[model samples]
Target: MSAGRHGRHEPVYRALELIANGLVRAQRLDLHVTGLENIPDTGGAVLCVNHTGYVDFLPLALGVQRAGRRTRFLIKSEVMDIGIMRFLVNHTRTVPVDRSRGAEAYRAALGRLREGYIVAVYPEATISRSFELKEFKSGAVRMAAEAGVPIIPAIVWGAHRQWTKGGARNMGRSRLPVHVRYGLPFTPGPDESPERETLRLRETMNSMLLEVQDSYGPHPPGEFWVPSRLGGAAPTPQEAAVIEADEALRKAEARAKRAADRARSRGSRR
Candidate 1:
């Protein structure tokens, strides 16, 4: 679908936006948004964002809203399983991807795109504990290709300072500055491989992220929010990979223990 063809925004989404804006104001966040014009006024587009922190989506969505477009984010099914989150996601029309059944979510996102809704996806798939760009997944490029929509590269910087993994949370009125930038949209060629397109998209967003960081000012030495290369104490990407791997192993073990306990309980009952 072309630009300027989408339907009106849902009432719940509008209401949530108001609450979110109020929260932003309450926290006195110093938000800097640029290149919003790159977001199509009204059209189906895949917004590929680099994830740095838990609240990265908020600032990025605010920037897109400034462009007069509401974004439907592709969220994980685990988050959707939460009672409150489930209600919010359902009411706001967000698409949920079950990792075990990813195709279902892909179809849902594609349908939304074809219906002319801007779909935001984090190609990194998770928050970067290292505060650096993680490797990109080809799903965003593949979705854009199938949906015939442009891929909009976006970057969010400085959000990790507020709240991040293994870091102290400061959701209070700290007056933190978060920067959001939107790069020009581009569509992959029909013959281009998804892997190649995904790599190019990552490179583009990485460059944009560096630019945002540069303009965002100097990083405090040994701070947890900045990447090690930039002089802060955040772990290097390689170290972060190990940490994430350990985390995954722990989660798997916990799940197995739970399953075994459930089985034993059932046997005792029998």
Candidate 2:
């Protein structure tokens, strides 16, 4: 995989991305990635992806990983307080902001990007019900403008299908083909407010999404797509090794802890 814009050559991003990517692969789900050639080879960048359902985040995450950039995401505050999710997200360096606290969240998002992390901000801000794109928000625009980083518009369609409005309860079906589209990097003029700038960026991103849809044509009742040829390099050794080691270590640690608990139980019986 190519190094991200920051020139840090991160394996952590690669590892985390690899683990999540299995979700895409094991299902035999194919990704149609377009404009990937447009992703900058090097510094901090903003990725604004379409939000649909819960699965939407994972597909987008995996897609970003495929692009070779580890993105720090702006996550909901409530999600941060959950048991293991907090640990996982924090470990990945995701920044969580309380939806209730608007100003603070905005500042924090920009601050993290300024700190040189490629942050993913959802311009839709919240989930949408519309089939087409909805009104765009400016959180992303403002952050990029303030941080002075280029912004990349991304759209992930078809994710809403597996768990459609009222579909099957189980996540069945393998190789659920998904589309991940990206647009060339662009920045808003410094004169605008974050909100205004965010909308401009969102509009451009929406265009990219629309373009992809046009190229692939309207998806079936539940689908989205990319025009990319279903081909790319094989998963690198570093990616595979990290994934194996992390899973093994997690299992070993869990087993050790379980053994300790059993010993405690036996001693307590005494």
Candidate 3:
């Protein structure tokens, strides 16, 4: 693995990295990481990653840390609202993205990249229940272009087996094998359209993802963590999309109900 110059260290970040890595080791996750040399040792870059499960970031960050760099992942602001999470996110200098005010998060990420930090982004925005690449958002490519940095595409496979949406958590000593692959970094051309570039990025990551899945071993038939196309019983992309839409609508209605209840309570007191 090629090493890059270490960026400025945050005591808290380093401590957390050690703890997380310790947990990973204890779990004995059979991690196979490749292409660490692709990560530049010293400058800014946007690390675009494919999201498969909730713990996907852990393995991806592990690989980045191996390259002598820490990742500032673009996490949703709601996660920052949690008590312990808030402290962790703040001290680790994670970029909190309020989806309702995404522009602010985008600008913050751009600033970090310009400051020579590796800003990691999940272009899919959410975990794919189908275990397949979802539609890509242009934000990652746009940020790289605007910040004048390279885009490094990365993929983590087999994380979903440990914990994922709609899947049972296996905190046991399953010793699952996780595969991480980082493709060579590339800079977007000044005149390239963001949409076109975003599509290319998605395609590249998708190809890498499939390659990792294929080489990871035979995906068992009817297994919950494997994609349906590969013989597992996981939802297809279309089925997962519908499930996600329903989940979103349900959450929106719940939020609206809570707002109305709060307003009623306030009026009664007045």
Please name the candidate that would achieve the greatest lDDT relative to the true structure.
3
**Which lDDT tens digits does candidate 3 get at residues 1-270?**
112355445778878888889989888999999999999988899999988888889999999989888888898899876899999888876899998899999999998888888989999999999989999999999999999999999989988899999999986678999999999899988899999999999989988987888789979898999899988889999999999999999999999999999999999999
Model 1, residue 134: what's the lDDT?
A: 90
RMSD of every prediction? 2.0, 13.0, 2.3
Better by lDDT, candidate 3 or 2: 3
What would the per-residue lDDT of candidate 2 be over residues 239-262, giving only the tens digit for each residue? 434554676699799989999999
Assess each prediction's global lDDT (C-alpha) against the native. Answer: 0.88, 0.66, 0.89
In angstroms, the error of model 1 at 119 is 0.9
Clashes of 3: 1
How well does candidate 2 match the true structure, expressed as C-alpha RMSD?
Answer: 13.0
**lDDT (Cα) of model 3:** 0.89
Error of 2 at 259 (Å): 41
| lDDT value, residue 74 of candidate 3 | 90
lDDT, candidate 3, at 31: 92
Please state the error at residue 129 of candidate 1 in Å: 1.6
Question: Clashes in each model (backbone N, CA, C under 3 Å)?
Answer: 0, 8, 1
Comparison by TM-score, 1 against 2, better one: 1
